[model samples]
Target: MGQGADHLTSNQAQVLDHLRAANAPMTAYQLLGRMQNDRGAVAPPTVYRALKALEEAGLIRRIETLRAWAPVATVRPGVVVICDDCGTVRGVEAPGLLESLHERLVAEGFAEARKTIEVHGRCGDCAEDRA
Candidate 1:
């Protein structure tokens, strides 16, 4: 379990483990399927609840555009770079960038703004392949 995840339920920890092992984002249903395949007959609600808890605890992030979830790779503010071609999602840490972004938002009168920025582009390997 992660530092903050010491209080997670068993199911939530399992979900977090699966997400950490995954190379890309996974939808809730997909997680359920994996669990069911491994352990048999896990309910959809069970997985959904676990996901909710994990997300709330900052152990995971939801990719709104893809409707998928990814493990939080760091404690910094969430930023994900999605590979449009291969569907790879990689977390990135940019505290300075996040601070500037929040500053800009505050300047525009957006109060207490929290952000999860998703940038879509080809990844290095994919770009090299294309080249």
Candidate 2:
């Protein structure tokens, strides 16, 4: 993780640490609050700059729907999963999933640029509670 921080500025490292410690996804504003509360001297622009660096490094993902972010698990490859019901986000490893989809798109004469897979439905706890 130190090596990852080496590529980022001090502020970015701090932001990444906060995101990694969080139990749930956090918005940039939430991160800014955390920085201000914890560091007591950090500025808002610092938080945003850090977030941008982490996003560029693929060390974290921004949840478009919720406009929040969650740390990428060390064991998982880069994949984002968003829960529709509670708006919780999780990361998983589905290595070839995107590649296969892109291939199929090309076969159908459609050029795929970017793809965001948002599976909408109740999460396990929510489903069980409803049942």
Candidate 3:
């Protein structure tokens, strides 16, 4: 519910609402299918536009591994986690770790650097299933 919502069309708002309501990440195609089934018909571009806006606003994130999107409740910068098996993602808080790494890099005189720490592994359900 950021200022990004103000820029969204009603269609975009509807798409964002649906994505937030979903329990799992969903591809644009999947969202399009649901919209078509419920609203009778929908265009692909509309979904893409809405997703792009939501992503830019940091209200949602795209899971590269799953090729899907999910809402982001927290925005603690410099943190990202991804489940390798199911592709479920969660944001984390690791300022200490990040600070340590940053200090080390600064000592080495690395001026510009961005951090994206992605941990890949099976989620709880996948681990249980495998077990």
TM-score top scorer: 1
Q: Tell me the lDDT of candidate 3.
A: 0.74
Off by over 4 Å in 1: 74-76
RMSD value for candidate 2: 3.1
Q: For model 2, which pairs clash?
A: none
What is the C-alpha local distance difference test score of candidate 1?
0.82
lDDT of 3 by residue, 1-131 (tens): 46544576777777778877776678999999988987887899988998898888777777665778777763235566666776556777888988899888899999745565656666688889889
Each candidate's lDDT (Cα)?
0.82, 0.71, 0.74
Distance (Å) between predicted and true CA of 40, model 3?
2.6
- Give a tens-digit lDDT track for model 1, residues 11-36: 98788888888888889999998888
lDDT for residue 128 in candidate 3, whole number 0-100: 93
Error of 2 at 66 (Å): 1.1
Model 3 residue 15 distance off true place after TM-score fit, in angstroms: 1.8
26-107: candidate 2 lDDT, tens digit per residue: 8888888887887677777777777778877767767666777777663234466666766666666677987787789999
Which is the leading candidate under lDDT?
A: 1
